[model samples]
Target: MTTFSNYIPQSNPPLPPWETLPTMYDLPSDNPEEPGLPDDFHFLQPLLLYLTFQPINWNPELVYSAADLNLYYDIQHPLWYKRPDWFGVVGVGKLYKGQDLRLSYVTWQEPANPFVVIELLSPGTEDEDLGTRTESAADKPPRKWEVYERILRIPYYIVFSRYTNELLAFQLVGGHYEPMNLTHGCLLMPEINLSLGLWQGSFRDIERLWLRWFTLEGELIPAPTEEAAAATQRAIIAEQEAIEAKQEAIEAKQEAIEAKQEAIEAKRKTEQLAERLRQLGVNPDDLDEFL
Candidate 1:
């Protein structure tokens, strides 16, 4: 056997050139110019991310092409120009090359386009969201509905109003989007095996309209915060059940003691009666014989 110190160590190799190594830049915000997408936008991001892990081709923030410069569409836009609030593509890698960060997603550059698009209606963009034309035609883009239905040709489009707590979904047909009823406030996206709907509950100490993802069967997908609350609720229920069971056992024991006391009292009364009859010279045995 060779001794532990007998083996020789090899020299370490030199570091590779920085140019050969891949460089990744931070993701760009679509509404960087504006005061950012709004507080509700943050709330909507996670639900969009959760939808990607499903069986459908779900890319969270896929970059798609518009013109030339890689425009990373929030989810993935077909062109470099416009970006939907939340979008999904059915057949794209979650990440390119497991590390090839995308500068932008150009549909022409990518193999697929978004199957669905969601717009979070805010006070600033409410008009555009409702398909109303902008009065000034100088530098504004076309209405959102026209772009989503005609240009992008996204199969499904959803508009959620935080103020009204309402959701509207449209499906593409004959090169146009037709409004579809979301019965009981549930919109089912069959492509992704999920549904998009509004859940009226409190989150982060804020009680307001929350956009949430759901299963096809209308079960609200629990956020991390919601899951914790549910667990706590279950624990409380179990504790209550244990307390009730203990109380019931104590009540049963008390009832048994009371029953035994009653039996003793009744037997004592019968003995006293027999003794009184014996003192009165009327034998209790003679009375029993007559009866």
Candidate 2:
């Protein structure tokens, strides 16, 4: 009698799951299950994060950040995902595999997970964003906090409320997230050489207290627009300085010419006086000795 058994096939040299598993294109990037459009703050805050998410220790080409992008964490459940307001990853290509733009951030296919994630608080998602909400069913998806802390194990998690202008931060330690104390109004992450804090400034022409990235020393990271503006201002100042330097040089030259003219005029007057003295039988060279 022949026994029937299941046979598993394997690849020689063992191809990684990324090559065999569903890629970003196979995953659904849209949030059709959820309803409602993001408010203006949602759009603006994330934009600011995306613009200034330059990790000082990481290469610019290797740093990638997204806002409102689906982050697929579970390989078993490829469909499950969380859309972070803003998330940043280091040691990963800015583009997908250095070739194409990513439709979604698939953790299994990517080299590294998000190092930091920011959630902008709203009335609807405040509980979930702050880890106050718990999943009612086992089959249901985990909360945002669970995914960030337990599953993906993101190093830094930040939440900000525009309404209250409050900033909260958490650091993953010993497989769990602990509340991080703000050091001088900012959460310092020395690994990435950056800080997360609230800035009372204008972004996108809207003036308010906004969540922003900062240097480890608590200096604000300039956005692209701000950097451009700073460059222009520097150029203008340089031009003004050059103009002032040229004017000073011209004034010095004029003074030198005037001094030379005065010396020549005095020499001519002395020569005339000497000639007149000679004509009167007096020596002009002896005048200084007499004086």
Candidate 3:
């Protein structure tokens, strides 16, 4: 049987689009000087990550997470740093020096390193994010991948692409990062007692697929806005129930008033009949025995 492949004139079959086009694997050169500026998606995605990052097992005061923060790692070269899209450091005070807010994260002065770092995929930064570059500039700081893996040894490194809605996660193992297999479209982090997954729901008045956190048991960690909406719905339901109860009480009261009126009318008719029997010279009291 002649197939579609046989219809081609060339001896070799044409390669698929995936082979010819540029992909995350073949991203551009890693030039730190030309770091891509963030767009609206970059701003929004990090905010979602920041809001839903509720580490249930950790104390609220100790769980600190932020987006677009410079993380200074090396003490020798204090100026050298990498600003991750979002990062979370557990077991550290939310305030710097336990007094005021921090401007940047300094590794040497901090109590602990970032437990996880997330990089939102931008076209210009994909190469460095995926560690495709073998080395960095001669006189400059190390690449982001090297800084996270070799220097800081962050426990988890995640890269998410909003354009493709793809999520990639790696865990530190034996001085190297090992890719983690997602279970049921979610990656579970037992340390945080939460799992990261794709949730197809509305956030910030926008409906789209979002990467949000869930409990290890698959319960959604609601944002503040969602909580407010749920509270409003509960209030509405409670008000309706109250109205129905009030109507029922009113109906019962009206029914009692009608029953009392009916009893008074019956008594008045009996008295009128007794008065008529006396006028006709018939004893009303002895009429029952005669009948």
Candidate 4:
């Protein structure tokens, strides 16, 4: 008999040639390169990224993957690359297949584009983030504002300034970003089913309002560790209550047994007194007349 493997036809798409792919650390020329930001800026970037990864209800379906703060997006254009301080892409698989890992996010290869982009403003890129001036308007691939708001068409754009403790949120409307007003330092993103706000709490020993996500009712979203801790506390309380109830039942049973034994002893003593009167031979019938 002919082997089944030989009968089946093999079909596979040809992989791209190695020469077309750029080498590691290959950054585009037009990319706004901020080699070094302030220490506080660096510290806040990872914290915000971690907070985004923590909350359970934020992305129940796990559509987005919270990528590293420094990973670059390799746009097909030779001289165009955009890297956000922190970014999240919806409708992308959490892991690339089983073996292939992403060194950098290439838009053509990835499943979906970034839905929201966050820029932690520094001294160098503050003006560009706010859409103030464009040095290479005609020559270069537009300004950062035009690229983020117009080209990429990202739904939500957030800029946070550590120097001034300022937070600004913009929502895409009519193919452009419009500044969104905040009520009590909170802006709701209905598309993502969450709110972006400044949370005042101690993270890594710093007490400040760090850029974080929250629920619709203005509750701070819980990290993975915090959720687990809450579940453990509830389990401990339930176990203690069960033990206390069991102990009470045991004590009640013991009290009931003791009461039954005392009644038996009292009945036995009364019977003995009656027998003693009979044994005294004083005529049980005559004892009633003497009384």
**Per-residue lDDT for 1-291 in model 4, tens only?**
779867977788676876567753353333356543435546665555555543334454445544343333335554466656777776666566535555566666666677777778765677887888755645556666777776677788888887788988899999988999986668887666677788777665668767877866677777665568779998999999999999999999999999899999998997787788888875556667888
Model 3 global lDDT (CA atoms, 0 to 1): 0.88
Please give the range of 10 consecutive residues that has the lowest summed lDDT in model 1. 64-73
Which tens-of-lDDT digit does each residue in 1-291 have in candidate 2? 533565556567977899999985465425655422366777988899888888898889999999889999998889999999889999999899789999999999999999999988765577788998756468888989999999999999998887788888899999999999989988999999998888988888899888889999988899989999999999999999999999999999999999999999999998898999999998878788989
Rank list by lDDT: 3, 2, 4, 1
What residue pairs are clashing in model 3?
none
- Which residue pairs clash in candidate 2? none
TM-score versus the correct structure, for each prediction: 0.59, 0.84, 0.75, 0.66
Q: CA lDDT of 40 in candidate 1?
A: 43
Q: What is the lDDT of residue 72 in candidate 1?
A: 34
- Cα lDDT tens digits, model 3, 41-143, are 6788778888888899999899898888889999989999999999998999999988989999999999999999999888778898988884978788999
Off by over 4 Å in 4: 1-44, 47-62, 66-76, 96-99, 183-185, 204-207, 251-291
Quality of model 1 by C-alpha lDDT: 0.65
Each candidate: what lDDT? 0.65, 0.88, 0.88, 0.69
Ranking by TM-score: 2, 3, 4, 1
Off by over 4 Å in 2: 1-36
TM-score of 4: 0.66
Q: Candidate 1: where are CA atoms >4 Å away?
A: 1-82, 89-113, 122-153, 161-166, 191-193, 215-219, 275-282, 289-291
